[model samples]
Target: MKNPLILLALAATLSATAADAAEVPLYETGPAEDSSFVRFVNGGQQPLEIVATGSNARLTLDTAKPASDFLPIRAGKPIEGALVRGGAKRNVSVTVQPGEFASVVGLDDAAGGLRTVVVHEQPDDFNALKASVAFYNLDAQCASAALLAAGRNIVLLDQVPEGQSKRRQINPVPLSVQLSCAGQAVGQPLDLGTLEAGQRYTVFLVPAGKQSRIFQATDTVAR
Candidate 1:
């Protein structure tokens, strides 16, 4: 027969090991399936920074790079943050439905302060054989923004109003584009390198010093 104290000690060790196993998680938790996505765009002349609540992540936007990649957040919950430009700070919030994508843009307010505009859209769906392009008119001075093929009258996107965006599918090809606002060209032509099939692109018409400039970025999703 086994010694009683020895068996008791062995049993106690087994129990403690079982308890530790129970405390350990089998897998790490990830974002929920119904989570939404959000990104930041700086439409104003000055560079902007965003510090979201409950997160240490910081998103910065400037003239060279006007948009940030999307980040996932809980659906229907407002993602509140502080928008910082130089020494000034202002509160901002954005909300979106489950499975939706949103862009929170910082624009120049009438008082020369910073204001925000939220643009929402469903997850992108497009033909696999073609590329997708979107145009966002965030320049308040541009009442109607139009995108055209450079050196040609070919209009890709036309008559987009301020704070609005439009998307279309196009055959994969190299192209140069120009921005015209309210029937007048705002900036010089921009060369969009060869577009690839199944890829996404976005062009933004943002405000500059008393004029407007165009920015381009490839759209991507977080894994």
Candidate 2:
């Protein structure tokens, strides 16, 4: 009923249109506008559970896995929740600014109660040619903490006070480091094998009896 040459031309036009549409990029769904990021870290001796209010998100952390992936939350609003340990619950709240990143650390108080500390992460200018490392000092007995290259006298991070953190950018390479607190070595050397460029890392010095224990984790965001 239609001209054969006209039909072929129409088909080619439709195919080109479909191909152009497919080439258009599709982006992932991101966090809400003005949202901040927050993560949980268990600096205590026991397993910790975070039950968020009005949300179904539940995060658990223990000595073996002491950190959680970052989650998006409304900025400038207090996040009300409970920290549960061994069936015991303690109410906790944390707040952060818009576009900020924070870590909520659960610790054992001197009075034998569950407590929390919010550590705001300092903004950094990312370097694509280097690796970023952050050190968190959660050991109360350690007035100051330091991270040094194992078998070498070089210190990567030094004089980090208790309840705080410090970050630095370094060359990407296979490396090992030792944790020291109060001028004494705290634990066995930590082997951080073959760091890649543009990656981020975090090391924590958590309290363990009279001494301290060290662990490392790669920073990640919750999808």
Candidate 3:
């Protein structure tokens, strides 16, 4: 009873709409209202794909490279997404405030599982004459840890709780990072090379079987 011409036109319209939808990207540019940045870090062994949806949303992040531009998500709104690794996935979420710098770290659980930890990055107000350093605890096996600057006889951070981070501004120095648990050293101290002025850095304490080790990455924060 339906006219053949009418049916063909309807089919054509539907096809064109679907094609247009596909051309649109899943993550669009955030509005000017968004004033903060959230970076994603994949600390797990497998590569990860990160996504977030909310005000001033961010398109997906590929592999291990952090979002070149910090996610322009609205402050205080919940940004939720999933982390896909090797065909398997896990959910992750976080809320950030205006002018705040935050990150989501992908970590491995004790039972061979995977999870995410949301960390509020310490703000850096240092000028070109100084530098900043922050330490993150990702070693699930280690309950707590500390960072000592070798030969300086100084403790940069003490009693850093698991899944948390602490940061401080310091003069340019050659730092030997050490991790301790239950007041005992986890392993040999790690030479963090040299920290230069006007740069922001993060040290990640990661698990190595019964003990743990340290890895570092430079943040893209402008001084």
How badly does each model clash, as a count of residue pairs? 0, 0, 0
Tell me the lDDT of model 3 at 77.
66
Q: In candidate 3, which residue pairs get closer than 3 Å at backbone N, Cα or C atoms, i.e. clash?
A: none
Candidate 2 C-alpha error for residue 175, in Å: 2.0
The residue-by-residue lDDT of candidate 2 on 1-223, one tens digit each, is 2111100111121011111112211012222347676777887779998776655446667877777656556677776777777756777777768767788777776666777777887455467678778888877777668999888968999877777788888899998989877677867899988877777788888766667788887665554
lDDT of 1 by residue, 1-223 (tens): 2111100111121011111112211011322458666767787768998775554546567877676655556677666777778776777767778877788878776667777777876634556677778888877777667998888968999777777788888899998889887777777999889987777788888777678888787665433
Output the better candidate (1/3) by lDDT.
Answer: 1
> Which residue segments of model 1 deviate by more than 4 Å?
1-35
Candidates ranked, most accurate by TM-score first: 2, 1, 3
Candidate 3 lDDT score at position 39 = 61
C-alpha RMSD of each candidate structure in angstroms: 14.2, 14.0, 11.9
Poorest stretch of ten by lDDT in candidate 2: 5-14
Worst 10 residues of 1 by lDDT: 5-14
lDDT winner, 2 or 3: 2
lDDT of 3 by residue, 87-182 (tens): 566777677777677777766567666677778863636556566788888776776577777555468887777778888778887778777676
Looking at model 3, residue 206 earns an lDDT score of 67
Could you tell me the lDDT of residue 200 within candidate 3? 70
